[model samples]
Target: MMLAGYLVAVLAGLFAVVAIYAMLSSLPNAPDYFSVVGVSPIAALLVPPLGMFIYFLTIVLTGMQTLVFALIAEFFSLRNALLHMMFGAIAAVAGFALIWPGASENPERWADMGIIGTAGVVAGLVYWLIAGRDAGFRRPLFERA
Candidate 1:
């Protein structure tokens, strides 16, 4: 269970990294900041091979996060966090590929991306919901699940 938790955090972190990198790469000027009904500071680090590092880190961090949650959910009884993380990551990666930025303008692509995104979110939520409660995290779903 301890190992599983570590894996989940690592994987979740990795996912964040990739998502951030993709988002940043798609934008211009390494954007100092951006907003979506609210303001957020943009990352400006200049890590070489930033894309590749992000990709790897995302895989690791997200895995760790997922594992940690899954283990907690199973009362430190389950030992399959790696499997859960792998499958969930697969779903997310597929969503990312299908709903890439270019698809924003293409109706078909946009629709596909939406579907994929929804799938990824649902899968992730399911894992987290179960894990959180099992682990006694007891926090309300931040975004209504």
Candidate 2:
């Protein structure tokens, strides 16, 4: 059950990242694929055929950070909402760093990073709600066995 919960938490965070990325990227001046050329933003989200690639790619990229944070949280038995949020933000920033090397050095890239970080924050909150509340609960016996 713990493993299942952890998986769910990670999945929730990844989805949150994809969602925020889609929403923010749909704004004016974003990439052509994200922009609503002949369709409404709502419609674009509803029919995210192109965005599917981005969604999967983000999950693959950010999954590592999420797993790392999960290990730390589990090891420390952390359940604080703020800490989880921070973890989320940090994971998102790490993913952004990987995707856009040197983008952080530029002022314009800061905005995009900010968006990713924001997504991570929300994802963290979601994770806390799901599994952080009972982090490492009653698991010592399993280790012994």
Candidate 3:
């Protein structure tokens, strides 16, 4: 169930980003959802689900980063949101860099950064909704206070 929820959230985020990108670019508004589903298996054969895994890991790590900042840096929730946004932007750029190296010089790269960052923000919001607005880290491996 947890995995299913995460998958759905990630896919939804991806589709939302694609849609927004299309709209902003004044390109065709049609989103080929079937293409994504159809290509997953072939793409996985090349990188073994690397894209999906990276997105999931990025979301989880961003949440952990947010928690760390909130706890150690005494950051407010707003600051936490900013931190997550920054992380998302960096992650998206870095992911693109790893995949396409010098493609950063392209104008479209900036647009992609915007889309991916927005997706990250959306994912974070969804996660917070599911996990709770005031959720905090807990340590089951350690003795109770």
Candidate 4:
């Protein structure tokens, strides 16, 4: 599972980087580094498609990450990895929500970035409630030395 996670993350990150590079190269009259940081209507127009593309890619990556992490935790016979992955996913979603508040508030928005946090929470909670016990819910037999 760890191997799977590693592979998926590397692949997805690589693809995202390539897409970003392509988008940057295709821009007309690209701004200087500092200028890129400032908000402009024109810039927003240029960014939406790329942002949507990246966000979709990120969602895929998160799904892959969650699956790989869960598999790893199961293979290692440890329950904590599930929690870690769940919380990590939630954090990622929250970060996106903060960055795209309008999307977060509006379900019909294009990217639906705002609901990521909520989805993460629901997924994690549901998984925990349903399959957590089988994945090592029992108390430890003895304290580690």
Candidate 5:
């Protein structure tokens, strides 16, 4: 269930990135969309969501392992938003690094790295917003609570 929520949030972020890219690519001065986007928009629209599922699954598994280790050492604590932000930063760097080698081959594609990194950060933030809150965190429906 949590994964579903995270998936929705990430997909929404990805859509926003694609929409922005599409708009920017249409500008007369903009570089070719294929070079900037690194893939056809059709593929761009389809690939990340699928890739993210795998990527996020890896994150979850690694987090679980870390949690288990922390628990064994009595160092575990409730989830923190700052920690989520840290994860977001890490994801952004990792995403950018993964594409850097290929992007370096073409000067035009270098600009796309920024766009891809931005998208990664957005996806991370969306995931954090959807799922990073601690169990004790709550919001009241009325202001007078």
Candidate 6:
């Protein structure tokens, strides 16, 4: 259960963060795409390529953060939504910092970071919804399944 939950939680976080990042990054009026039938499909079409690119970057940049946080949670038995959210935001921001080679040249660097951090929070919430709430629970070895 723990392994399954962990995998689902991580995947959920990854997808949420990437989807949100893609939506906000590519869409001019992102909110309109949320419900309008005409544009929603178009926006959906944009996600896959961007998602793959961002997914790879996220895995490379934030992988350590994710692993460290998961380890900390496992050892400390952390199940707090806030902690997960914090971890997600930190990981995302850290990833952004790690990836941007010319941060000084980019005028909108902070804006991108803000978007990513917000998405990370949402992702963390999604993770918590699926798995984080029961973090670090260990059944007794002798207990019957």
Off by over 4 Å in 4: 1-62, 80-114, 136-145
* Each candidate: RMSD: 13.8, 5.9, 8.0, 13.1, 6.9, 6.0
Q: How are the candidates ranked when ordered by lDDT, highest leading?
A: 2, 6, 5, 3, 4, 1
Q: State the lDDT of candidate 5 residue by residue for 88-144, as single tens digits.
A: 445544555564657667777666656655665565556556655522234446766
| Tens-digit per-residue lDDT, 19-94, candidate 6 | 6655664667554433343344355467877646644666678778877886787677788999988887877777
Residue 102's lDDT within candidate 4 is 71
What's the TM-score of every candidate structure?
A: 0.28, 0.68, 0.46, 0.32, 0.51, 0.63
Candidate 1: where are CA atoms >4 Å away? 1-99, 134-145
* Model 4 quality (TM-score): 0.32
- Candidate 5 regions off by >4 Å? 34-86, 99-107, 135-145
lDDT of 3: 0.50
Question: Clashes in candidate 4: how many?
Answer: 1
**Which wins on TM-score, candidate 1 or candidate 6?**
6
Which lDDT tens digits does candidate 3 get at residues 11-75?
55665565665455454552454345434545645896786785666555444444443343223
Q: Lowest summed-lDDT stretch of 10 residues in model 1?
A: 33-42
Task: List the candidate 6 regions with Cα displacement exceeding 4 Å.
Answer: 1-51, 102-107, 137-145
- Name the better of 1 and 2 by TM-score: 2
Model number with the top TM-score: 2
Over 11-42, each residue of candidate 4 has an lDDT whose tens digit, in order, gives: 34333333443454446764343133332324
Residue-level lDDT for 61 in candidate 3: 45
TM-score of 1: 0.28
Cα error, residue 9 of model 2, in Å, equals 5.9
